[model samples]
Target: MTHIAVLGSTNMDLVAFVEKAPQRGETVTGREFRTIPGGKGANQAVAAARAGATVSMIGAVGNDSFGARLRSTLEHSGVETDHLRTTEGSSGTAHIVVDDHGGNAIVVIPGANGTVDHLVPGDEGLIATADALLLQLEIPLAAVLAGAQAARAHGVRTILTPAPAQPLLPELLAATDLLLPNEHEAAALTGRTDPRSAALALLERVPQVVVTLGAEGSLYATRDAEPVTVPAPRVTALDTTGAGDTFAGTLAVAITEGRPMPEALAWAAAAASLSVQRAGASESMPYRPEIEARYTS
Candidate 1:
């Protein structure tokens, strides 16, 4: 089994589904309200586990009912939560609004996730044993940096998802083996809207970069070769919340299993395509067999 370590945030998602979002200072009703377990970190961990990786999650949650549900969700998805800590306050939460067309807007409350400013003693040991360490910006930057440094010290691959895009410090970039960002994030980071140009620019900071283009698939770039745009299977999307997470997690699993970059991107795309046809984050992710069937079909 492929061992993957994730050191990040865990949150309870409060979602509202509607035909269209309300304007500022205006009130509108939604079709339904639901709560789900998600946080970029938790979602990615669940994605990797569902893709057949033996995933160990290292993060913090609050001592609340939502936190309990979040923990149980990961455990149910086959993720090892031995290092998941529970703090004395509310768990992190994302106030999400999903439009009928599958687009979404979200507001994240840090809660316990903000408290994880740095790693505890056992965190490094957990990262050292993994094939790759999956990280996101939902948690504190200091903790993200510490996780990256530890992974570097242990010679473990570090895959950083620069989500909720923000300025990246130089030290963190040096420790990163792969940087994954969506097209908008790439443009925000590099000031380049064209995926190829943006990807090439990112390569100067990290050894490799993958820019996800939604239905257009993903662009892969490395210092050693020219960039390639892998195409995604065309499919109607119902919800795109977990699509990127599914892609990143499945890509990590594929790489660990020794698939070439091109083949791995294809597998990841297939997995993500399956996700968009469903609803909710984590719940939308496809399993290993499902991904294989989609890829082969």
Candidate 2:
């Protein structure tokens, strides 16, 4: 199995299902409420492990019930959490509101995740052993940069998902082997609304880019390679909370296993399609056999 390393955040997702999202300064009634173990970091780790990669997570949680649940959830999903730290405070939390149409809006409060500003000793060694390193912006930008630098030095392929989109530094972009951003994120990163143009704008900073267009598909681009578009499998989406993370994790695993880009994107799309059919974050990801069966069928 491909050894994948993820350096990111872990949060407890407090989700409320409602008929529709609340408008500005409006209070809306919700039908149900639940807490799920999540965080872009944890979600991707679980997704990759379920997709058959040997995944290790390097992140911090808080000394709280949510933290315990998050760690246990990752363990149950077959992720190695030896480097998961527990701080003496509240765990990170994401307040999410899901509409009847499966659309979601989220607000994140970084608690322990904010504390992960630097890599502790031995963290670099862990990155060195991985076939690929996955990172997200949910954690401190300093830590993300450190992880990317370590991966680059160790000759490990580095995939960066710039979520909760923010302005990225040139140094961070230079260290990224692949940049995966959703359409909105791509627009924020490159200041271009057109997916193809946005991707082209990003290539000037990173060598490779994948712009995810939810429901429609995804577009892939590399410096010397022709751009390719992969259509997503049609499915009735119940919840799309972790679909992008699922796609990124499966794509990273497939690439680490030496699958070609097109095939890997296809596999990722299939896995994401399955994830959207369910609810929650990590809980929605499908296993390797399930993904394979979906693809073969």
Candidate 3:
């Protein structure tokens, strides 16, 4: 199996399902509510594991009930959590609202996630053993940069998801092997509303980029090759939460397994399609067999 390392955050997702999301300063009734285990890092870890990768998670959870559940959830999903630390105070949490259209809005509280500013003992070694390292912006930028740098030093491929987009440092870009961003995030990073334009612009900094277009699929670009566009499997979405992470994590597994870029992107898109058809984050990711079935259909 391809070994993947994840450096990111762990959060309990507090999700509210409603007919429509409330507007600013507005009160609206929700149909249902559920607390799900998530966080960009944890979601990716679970996605990759379910996709048949031997995944290890490196991050921190709080000394609260959510923290214990978070770690248990990862372990249950077959992710090794030897490097996942338990710190003081509350675990991270994402306050999420899902509308009937399958669209979502989220607010993240860093909590214990904010404390992971740097790698603790054994993090570098764990990263060094991986075929690929998955990263996201949910944790401290310092930790993200450090993880990327460590992966670079070990010649391990680093896949970064720049969600909740922010200005990135040159050093972090230099260390990243693949920069995966959704349409909105790509536009934010490159000032190009077009996904293709944004991906091309991103190639100037990172050698490779994948810009995800919801429903339409994903675009892959590299410094020295023609871009590839992979279409998503047509399906109705139930809750679009965690779809992007599903794509990123599954893509890493496909790539590490030596699938061609086009095939890899399509496989990842299949996983994302399955995720959106279900509710919650980590709970929604499909397993390897399900992904294969969807991709082949």
Candidate 4:
């Protein structure tokens, strides 16, 4: 089994679907609502687990109802939660608004997730046992750095997703094996609006970088070779949320299984294409069999 450890946040997603998102001081009626299990960390864990990896989640949830459901959801998706801690108080929540065009805006209220500012007992051991350590910026920077540092020390591949883009520390980039960022995040990080320029700039710090371009697929850059662009399979998207997480998770699984980077990117893109055709983050992830079929076909 491909063992992947995900160290990050866990939150309950409170989603509202509207024809269009509301503007400042404007209230718009939503067409639908849902409470979904998600956090960048939890979602990636689910995506990896469903994509045939033995995935473990190292994060914190609260002792509230949402927390319980979140843990169960991870378990249901075949993610190992032995390192998932339960803290006192409300769980983290992501207030999301999805527009008809499949775009979304979100506000995350960190509750128990905020408590994970440092690694707890068993965190390093769990991370050490994995073939890859997956990370995201949804949690505290210290904990994310700790996980990356541990992964680097153990020779485990570290894939860092720079979501909710923020300025990154040099130490964090130095430890990251692969940096995954969406187009917007890439632009924000490098102050360059173009993906090619942004990715090449990131490669100066990290060994490899993958800039996700939604329908345009993804771009892969590495120090050893020229950048490669892989096109995503075309599909009507119902919800674009979690597509990057899905891609990152499936790509990690594929890489752990010894697939070449190009093929892995194709597989991840297929998985992401499948995800956008559905709604919700973790709920939309396709299993390994489905991803394989999409990749081959």
Model 4 lDDT per residue over 205-279, tens place: 998999999999999999989999999999999999889999999999999999998999999999999999998
lDDT score of residue 219 within candidate 3: 92
Question: Which one is best on lDDT?
Answer: 3
- RMSD of candidate 1 to the truth, in angstroms, is 0.8
State candidate 3's TM-score: 0.99
Worst 10 residues of 2 by lDDT: 225-234
- Per-structure clash totals for the candidates: 0, 0, 0, 0
Cα lDDT of model 3 by residue, 1-297, tens digit: 999999999999999999999999999999999999999999999999999999999999999999999999999999999999999999999999999999999999999999999998899999999999999999989999999999999999999999779999999999999999999999999999999989999999999999999999999999999888889999999999999999999999999999999999999999999999999999999999999999998
Model 2 spans with C-alpha error above 4 angstroms = none
Candidate 3 clashes between residue pairs 3 or more apart in a chain or in different chains = none
| TM-score: model 1 vs. ground truth | 0.99
- lDDT per residue (tens digit) for residues 146-216 in model 2: 99999999999999999989999888999999999999999998889999999998999999999999998
Q: Score candidate 2 by lDDT.
A: 0.95
TM-scores, all candidates, are 0.99, 0.99, 0.99, 0.99
Q: CA lDDT, every prediction? A: 0.93, 0.95, 0.96, 0.94
Model 1 residue runs over 4 Å out of place are none
lDDT of 1 at 51: 95
